[model samples]
Target: MRFSSRVNAGAMNPIAAQAAAAKAAGHPLGQLNDSNPTHHGLAPQFLPEAYTADPRGPLGARQAIADFINASRGRGVDSANAPAAPAVDPSNLYVLSSTSEAYAWLAMLLCNPGEAILMPKPGYPLIESICNLTATRAIPYQQFFDGSWALDLASIENALREGNGSVKAIAVINPNNPTGAYTKLGERQRLVELAKRYDAAIIADEVFYDFTLEPFDGNARWAGEQGVLTFSLDGFSKMLAAPHAKVGWIEVSGPAEDVAQAERHLDMISDDFLPMSNLIADCIPAMLQEAATQTERVAARVRGNMAELHRLLDADKQSGDGVVDVLRSEGGWNVLLRFPSSIDENALGLRLAHDFHMNCQPGYYFDMQSNGFLSISLLPEPTQFERNVQIILEAVHRELA
Candidate 1:
């Protein structure tokens, strides 16, 4: 039995292997790498009416999504300081199971076998698997971090130029995972220009759009951008803290001809799978209307945990032997901590699990370029999170001593 090389090339990386080993050890693991809100006790309540709804989903749900995007992105408001983001049309929205499925559909729509897609380095690692599944190639462009993460436009342009026009699409995660840097307006403009120049589509994953911790000046919605075909992906996974609900969407916008052609292809792709559960689709309007309540709970938890982390780290620094430096994160559910150069991240992670009974992810899991970085979840229960942080700090201090 012969399998395709793409399938053969795709396997779980070492980080996942270590995580599994830790789980199998049956110790009381304080998980600091969790992202699932439900696991942290933030599940949403669904309406009973959802159970008997149409399989294609209700129009009301799509309209609710449009309204949520418009209001959140500061569109249709009278404020002078607000970005002039156009209102999203419900007709352009298509429901899906999750962002993972959305990526797969987009990959199928944009690329043929062996065609390339540009992704960001030090970003989410799942895109490679998505591309591999669709028989597409995932090429990464660098994002350099000084005080904050910045787009390396020269690197992106070089990637496109070097691809010889085989690059089908570029993926941008607004308020990117781990790094938590929002794509600025200038960066978005440059990206659209690059896409137009290379004749490729743009895939904007704004799943963490609602979790901004500071006042940001740029627009979050990409649904109404002109001149280039753009697919803006988001879902209930992050917005309502309802990952178990498995609801997501893609909003298509561009020149009329391009959008129409893309929609025709996407419709066929979506129809074949019909992945969105009817119940979740029907519950979307209520879920979205009540989203603030759930998101506020999550936001408060994340903020509380982050504050505790900072306070603890500050105390450690005051002790004059602190070995961890918390990286600046503008938004998102995870925070990055850079440890001393002497510590091996993988070894530290293993030791934390086996000796300290704390489960945390090493930075290599997120494609960090160095060995001393660790990514810890900000979504764990507050008390558990505090305990985990103290354990982590003690371990680091011991190592430094």
Candidate 2:
């Protein structure tokens, strides 16, 4: 039995690295490290009504899921007689404990050892680890940022043309994590076309899809209608502010023919893990029924926190210490605040914890080489977020200046 080298010696997952380092120092981390909701207090939203609802209750989880599938948005689970859920069928949607677990199944289903996929750098830290954990390769592309993040399409084109064409998938974090910028609608179209041209598939991790700070709502994207295939990932973790529920899903949307093939493969993979815990998987239906009300409330809190953050940053943007530009996001609970590269982020992160008692994430964690990219969660109540932001801003100002 031989082990692959990439899996053994690539950059370690940053979240895990931070946890280990924290435990080593005897100061459990402040935990701005992982995107899990438990850190930010989203566990309250994740409580499954089914947990309290009786097994004999007519409208408990099992029925709620059935009704939600029959509803318009849950097109993924339409009928049991059908081989796969219609995009509208609730049953077609498969939830995972975390997007990381979703990544595991996806990697195993798509790649063989030694095969690769083009992932964007300065992006999600889990992207590569997921591949490595599953014994596959994550070759990276650049998500360029001078001020706002943008795709370096030329590099993508070159990689696609230059490679031996072994790559079978490409991932884009729409309204990317760490970056917090939406994939431009025009760019989204181009991505679909690119996947088709390369004979590859798209995996859009849109966990942050509902957290838009933008004025307008992004569209309900469906790749199945287009000639290309895509697996759009999202879950209660972000949608319902319920990370404690451990509900995440991979949506198969693409051209009918390709989707059929993709589904055949994905269903087998999902079934292998079969009977996703009855608890949260059971909550999906009730969650959907109450989505309209719950989503609005969550969105309001997130929107308020985002607005407050901007007000503080904007008021001091012209100060002598220099300005920090916060990335404007369309959908997601986080923002990327970029600062002077002169100051080290990891050092600053440590200082924020020890000196200011505030926790913030460094940019490098996301494979972002540029320093001063800090990630913060919007789950904190308005007052807590406001206080923490000031601590970070003041620290960066004092340390860097």
TM-score of each: 0.83, 0.75
For candidate 2, the TM-score is: 0.75
305-379 in candidate 1: lDDT tens per residue? 888899889988899877787888778898888898688887788778888987888888888888898888889
Residue-level lDDT tens digits of model 2 in 235-262: 6666666767676666666666766656
The CA root-mean-square deviation of candidate 2, after full C-alpha superposition on the true structure, stands at 14.5
Model 1, global lDDT = 0.79
- Spell out the clash pairs found in candidate 1: none
| Model 2, runs deviating above 4 Å | 1-87, 90-92, 215-225, 277-280, 317-322
Instruction: Give the winner by TM-score.
Output: 1
